[model samples]
Target: MRRVKLSDQIAEDLRRWIVRENLGPKDRLPNERALQDHYGCSRGTMREALKALEVEGLLIMHSGPNGGPEVQQTSAEIASRQLRQFLHFQKLDFKHVYELRRSMEVALALNVVDRLTAEHLTALEDNIRLCENANNEQERELARQAEVEFHDILAEASDNPILVFICQFLNGLIRDLVDYRAGSLQEHEAFGARNVAYHKEILAAFKARDRDAVAKAMDEHMCCAETSMQQLDAAFYSDLLSRR
Candidate 1:
């Protein structure tokens, strides 16, 4: 078993305290010495704990005589970025991501099917146009990102905060995998066309407010995307092996 650092433990306690106190942005913590006294730790340990929180974006550390740690608004992007960074060191693969998405994204779709506003609908429609209009490699890359944004638009519409956060993170992972992998423009063009077709079907279901069709279409879409991602992963690995 791994031993936990005292500094880490205190940082966690501080996090819980912030939540319990309902602290908001710009809320200041006790002075360095005061916090040091409260945690009964040495100056080094206290500084490490405070720095951890700062790295997590939970607090903004100010220096000097008038300086201390102040609370900051937590962001989904921060959490997602942290998770993505961690996953980079793991043996995670394309299928691993899709395994979660195949089910979770379906739920996300159903949750937001009836919640999307006219603005949301417009954004979704506009995104498809962007995908179809992509011509160059740079433009095609942007289209791939916009494809992810289509789900992000749905994710933002869902009332379930947890669902929205996880979906947003998964979308980030998808973007990284698809954008960074070795692929021919011909392959991407095919994948892009397939994605546009699926998005169109999903949008039609949303417009008609058909829950059954939405669920069915979304599952099929994820499955198709998984296959395309598998091809990309194979190509990436093959290219890596050739270099050996």
Candidate 2:
């Protein structure tokens, strides 16, 4: 069995302590010496623990006379990055990703349709507009990214925090796959046009608060998207093999 590092144990303890004491963002951890004394740890070990927590985004380190560790508000970006590192050695691929999307995206859309605010609706519309208004390759790439951002807006309308985080992480993976795919401007333009149409349809369903329509549109869009992404994946591998 692998042994856990002392710093890791201490970091986890600090995390639990923060939660138990109801410490939130901007809450300062006790000074290093105080923490060292409390944990019966040497100064160097305490410093290592604090540094580890800082790297995990659990704490922010301060400097000088008023320097110590402070709690920082964690974000989905941190969570997604951590997930990526953990899954890097695994054989997780686009098909596995879309399989998860197929099961969850439709339900999430239906759940959030009634909860979308006017601002959320406007953002969704803007996402589609970005795709349509793109006049160059760079702008079209941005527009393609906006296609995924459309679902992110809907994810935020969810009252469930876990659902929001999982969806954000999955979308992050999708964006990475999007970047890795090998395709020409023609293929990209075709995908972008499909994205615009789907987003427009989904946005209309959301505005009407039509749960059925939202579910149907989201499922269809994700299904079609999975096919597009798979084609891109095939092209990417084919190019790599040809080069070899």
Candidate 3:
């Protein structure tokens, strides 16, 4: 087994303390010297461990007297960033990410269709209008955010916090894939517009409380997204292999 670094072990121990103590946001952690004594590590090693927690957004460091690391509420942004880093490190390509998204999102859509309210429908309509009227790069970004909002709302409507959390986490990855493949924006836009149409159809199904129609629409939408991503991957890998 690979030997874990002392700093890492210190970090893990501190993390356990946070949980065991039920530390809340703004709860002050033990001072650096205290941690050094408790963990039986050097001051430098203790600081390194604290820095890791700080980077993870679990703790914030303050200076001066009464100054120490404090626990912070974890944000979805933090989780998303960590997940993005992990995905990048693993070299999981855009296609694989899309496949994972399609599987989760399609099911989320189906579950949410019957739960959507008039307010939800209105919000979705506004998002589609934004997409339709987007004329510049800034507007296009707003349109993309609106598109994400629509799905996010659907995930929320599913009434499952776990699903909402997962969708929120994955949203950043989806944005990254879209940005990375923007050289194919025109093609993506074409497919995306079709996706908007499918969204409308799913909304209609929702209005009618037609579960089967909703399921079919979601499945079709995911199938199209999967097909497009696969094609893009094929072209990308083919060019890469040709260069080598």
Candidate 4:
């Protein structure tokens, strides 16, 4: 049978202590000597436990007269990075990822249609304009970033934190994939026009609060974008995975 390490046990105890005390991100952990005494562990064991927590992004250690380990609030970006690492190891391609995105985002659109506010609508409109008004390559890339942000905003409107994080993470993965194959897959001018049209259709459906229309529009948009990417580079998905 395997044995648990002393340091790991101490780490678990420290985690429980944080929870029991309801420590917030800004809360500082007790200093090293205090932690060692409280846990009845050696200095080396305390350091190991703290290091483990730090690696998991649960705590950040600092030094100097006023610095020590502080509880670090979990961030979606950190969660997304962990997910990306897992997906990378699986050797997933764009097509594989997009297949999942299509289902999730279609449902998310339907959920958001009735929940959208004027502010949300304005944000979506701004993103569309950002994409439509790009005058140069740099501007166009900014537009692409805005396009990604559009999906994130829509996901947020769903009022489901878990769904929002997942959709945003998928968007991040796609953006990174494109960045990897940057010069090789410059979108055609016509592609931008179609993208804008798709967004407008979806936004119009949301404005009308037509859940079914919003779902259909989102599905169509996803399908068209996937098809366009594949047509532009037949091996785009595989190329992205291979590059990584």
Clash tally, candidates in order: 0, 0, 0, 0
Question: Model 3 off-target regions past 4 Å?
Answer: 114-118, 135-146, 238-244
- Over 1-244, each residue of candidate 1 has an lDDT whose tens digit, in order, gives 9999999999999999999999999889898899999989999999999999999999999999989999999887999998998998997779999999899889999999889999999999998898889834657787788888889999989999999988999999998787677362357777888999999999999999999999999999999999988887887888889989
Task: Quote the positional error of residue 243 for candidate 4 in Å.
Answer: 12
Task: Give lDDT tens digits, candidate 4, residues 147-198.
Answer: 7788988887777887887788889887776565445555645666788899
- What is the C-alpha RMSD, rounded to one decimal, of candidate 4? 3.5
What local distance difference test score does each model get?
0.90, 0.83, 0.76, 0.81
* lDDT of candidate model 1 versus the reference: 0.90
Best by lDDT: 1
| TM-score, model 1 to reference | 0.93
Clashing pairs in 1: none
Which runs of model 2 end up more than 4 angstroms from their true locations?
A: 135-138, 182-186
